[model samples]
Target: MTNVREAALDVIEKINKNQAYSNLLLNETINKHKLIRKDIGLLTEIVYGTIQRQKTLDFYLDDFLTNRKKIQPWVISLLHLSLYQMIYLDRVPDRAVIHEAVEIAKKRGHKGITGMVNGVLRNVQRKGLKDFSSISDSAERVSIEKSHPLWLVKRWIEQFGLAETEAMCEENLQAPYVTARVNTMKTTVEQVLHELSEAGLDVIKGDLSEDAIKVIQGHLIETDVYKSGEVTIQDESSMLVARALDVESGQAILDACAAPGGKTTHIAERLQGEGYVQSLDLHEHKIKLIKKQAERLGLTNVEAMALDSRLVTDKFEENSFDRVLVDAPCTGFGVLRRKPDIKWSKKPEDVERITSVQWGILDSQASLVKPGGKLVYSTCTIEEAENQEIVAAFLKDHPEFSMDNTMIERLPNGVEPYVDGGELQLLPHYFGTDGFYIATLIKDS
Candidate 1:
């Protein structure tokens, strides 16, 4: 049997040393190790759990280590994996974890290092986590509880207030919900639910979108329903982007920045093959992804292209599209549940840089909308600079475009009044969905 703990340690080392994305690195490690189903489950839990709780684990390590010498990355990762099992996996015996840690350490580190790992982990086990609660500094307390970078925690506390920041941080630590958009072209929401139930999977209809269904606790990708392409895994917030566009038969639509084609196919499916949906992204390789999704969904109306959205006016005629969806790129703070590493990877300066690009794309695409047609600007982020602030600025400069509030009613129920000046912001903890922002605007004749 492959050593799941060692595999997890290697993945974690890669994350810290090579700056690899945790999820991508974990998936690659699992494949390389050829882990069985059970091993894969344990390895995934160890790697992600350690990364998610790195701050807390480090805090405990600090208390146990007397020398305060900086340990190597591999040793740090090894201790992280072992400590995670001790605290989180109550079913696993502490002795078992200790033994595995020593064995793994013997292979990777010297005998002295193995002795140190045992001493530190056992000391933590004896002390328990009671002392972590008494940390006085708000930054320290939030870091342990939320398992986020001190810089990010402080920034959120400033932006969202104390209570909301704590809530957002805790929410990010939870496993992301598995949400899928039913291929309305192949089946109805009810029909897909029935099919999933027959296959012995537990699922509930999404409270936010009529076409979205939330998988109860497991992944929907493993199910035959997903493999056959009857549904696509997407967050409820993302599902709303396509719905906000409200494509109609025989109307031409443009999905700028369409990759992995979630909204692009949704637009084509909603148009029912009568209208043409042109999907564009800057990378030529991503165009294949769009085409692959289109083929899977049996959607023929979508035409994938590789083009920069900032040059849309130069590439396509003004007033050519009846509808346009610009899912602009941003810091992606809104969807932290799925991509927890983003909290650590992003910096404050990135917001300004991405917002500038969003502004440019919005300005370029604004002219492409036919008079009286719809333009939907959406992002998987909750920052004001990227959402309302950008849209507000656009509306001020482009007098011909006006906010449309009626679009909120088109969204699924239980989506609270996130509409601020006709912009829909979905918070992660609010609807058990990824945090997202969408705004629909109409060009006046």
Candidate 2:
């Protein structure tokens, strides 16, 4: 039997040294090992836990290394995995982790390096962790508490005040809940819940959206209901965007930036094959993703296209669509639970650059809505510049459009009053969903 710890070490090395995404590398390695269900769980935990707490692990390592010579990336990765098991997995004894690390080091490195590895880890075990209070910087404290990069922590502190920033950081550390939207067109929520329960799955009703079901302790992907396209995995916050659009049957809808077709499929399902849903994204590959989803959901009204929404006026007549959804891309600070590495990878300036692009897309797509038609602007981000400020600025420039408060009434249940001048903002910690923002606008006749 291959050592599951060794496999995790290999995947961690690829993530840190080779600069690969943690999820992608984990999936690839798991498939390659052909591991049993239990080993697969262990391998996933070790890899993700090590990467997620890398900053804390490195801080612990500082106590052990005397000279702190530049260690090779793979050795550092191996040490991280060993330390993670020693500290986090109480079932795995410390001596066993040390033994495995020493053995792996000896096999992969020279005798002296193996000795160094053993000595350093043992010293850390003895010295315990260093306190961050000594640093005396608020940003540094936030970084240690949240395991976030100092720059990001500093930015949040400046933008959201210390207490709220700390809360946001703490929220990001929790494991994300598995939320899925029932395809009402294919099966009712009651039918899906009954079928899932019969299959020995543990699921609970979602708090915010009636159509959403939160998976408590089962892999819904393995269930026939999910595989057969009776449900689609989407966040409760995301499910609100489609419902907020208040789509009607026999209307012509344009989903700008639609890829992987989550919202597009939801719109089609709501329309019940009465409306024509044109799903357009910039990439040809993404067009296939939309097509595949439509095929799976048995949706006939969605037409997938590979065209830029920003240049829609050149291709389609003005006032062409009854409703247009511009789910513009932004720095995804909202879904950090799924993409932890983004905390380390993103720069502060990235926000401004991405917001600029979002503005252009919003401006271009707003023209596609017919006079008296509705337009929805949404993003999976909590940043004000990407959410409220974007919509506020758009309304100032366009006199023909006005806010629609009635759209909020159509949202899923328990969604608090996040509406401000027709926009809705959903914070992750508050909504138990990814941070999301939505605004509905109607063109004045």
Candidate 3:
């Protein structure tokens, strides 16, 4: 348990210093420590919970700490981890939490530091934390309560209204479900669910896409079902991209910014070993990931290459493909449930830089879509500037393309009402899914 707390603190400290993503760092720490299954759950809970509620935890710690500037960053991180378990996790008693924290401080710091750690936690346990509800400013209150940045909270309040922004912020703190896309080329959703159940895992059907399955209990990736390519782990909202492309047999497709190939492979599966899909990424190593998924799923039609999509015109002529997908790079605000570290790592200024990259990718790839063909722009972000504004800017500059309403017909039942003016902005509160945005466009014939 002490080792588990220490492991969680190690991940949190690195994340604070901008060393690595929380998801990656947590996995690395777990494997490095060779933690068992039970400890793995506790470690994950502490790491994610601490990061998810970081701003709120800091608000609580501010009441107890006399001089926060003098405290070491790692020591502050330790407090965050300890306070998280004390406030959020009911299974661990107050005594056990403080004992382990003090033990960690004793090993890592001097005598005075250990005493400080002991005194602060014991005081917090006795006096209890102050209620953040008393905060008068809506954005500040929501930011502190939900553990999101104050800037983000204010931005969202302006876009989504105060009520919806608060709901979305609340939703971000909850853990996301493990969703997988069933490989139709290899099997069906019913078959994968059966296989998962037979393996003693609790599973359910996804609400967004028919191809998705939600694993309620146990590791779906570790099972033979996933390794054998019967399923690929993906978010339900992300699985919507391939369906929006409306692929048919033998249609040429281009997946710009394809990597780690979740959607690229889903598009290939829809083609059913018939159509050719040209998948491109800037990095050679990421292209390898696409190829691996393609090979694993026995997809023969996907041709992945190590080339920047912005330079795509250099290799392919205009109007060369039947459909194109620009899963543009943006500040990933939507999937905060899965990657809470994104909340702290991404700055508001990143929106302008990423939107420029997104527009560049769209501009470079738009000419590749065949006349009368479809092109879909999607992102794992809720920012209007990144999603709807980029599409508006594209349509304003290029008159040949118009919003395609036909794609909405193909979407799953519950999601169409959210589509306004042929674009869908899925907030985290929408369906307990990631905050995503999608807009489908048609090239004028």
Best candidate (score: lDDT):
3
The collision pairs in model 1 are: none
- What is the number of backbone collisions in each predicted candidate, taken in the order shown? 0, 0, 0
Expressed as tens digits, the lDDT of each residue in 1-445 for candidate 2 is 2378888888877766666787888788878978888888788778777877888788778777666667788888888889988888898888888998998898889998899889988887887777777778888877875688888777777766898777877787777878999998888898888999999998888888889998987889899999899999998889988888889999999999898799999999999889789999999999999999889888899998899888888888888999999999988888877777666676879889998899999999877898889999999987888888898889998988899888868876566556766788876777668888899999997
Candidate 1 TM-score versus the reference: 0.95
Tell me, by TM-score, which candidate is best: 3
- TM agreement with the true structure for every prediction: 0.95, 0.94, 0.98
TM-score of 2: 0.94
Which sequence of candidate numbers ranks them by TM-score, best first? Answer: 3, 1, 2
lDDT of each: 0.84, 0.84, 0.91
Candidate 1 per-residue C-alpha lDDT over 1-445 given as tens digits, one digit per residue, 9 for 90 to 100: 2288878888888777766788788788878978888888788778778888887788777777777566777887788888888988898899899889988888988989999999888887788765666888987698787788787778767766788778877888787768889998898899889989888888889877889898886557777888788998888789888778877899999999899799998898899879899999999999999999888888899999999999988889989999999999889888777776677677888888999999998888988999989999999987878988999999999999999877876777666466665678876777777878899999998
Angstrom error of the Cα, residue 58, model 2: value is 2.2
Alpha-carbon RMSD, each predicted model: 1.7, 2.0, 1.0
- Cα lDDT of model 3 by residue, 341-389, tens digit: 8988888889988999999999998889999999999999999999999
Task: Please rank every candidate by lDDT, starting with the best.
Answer: 3, 2, 1
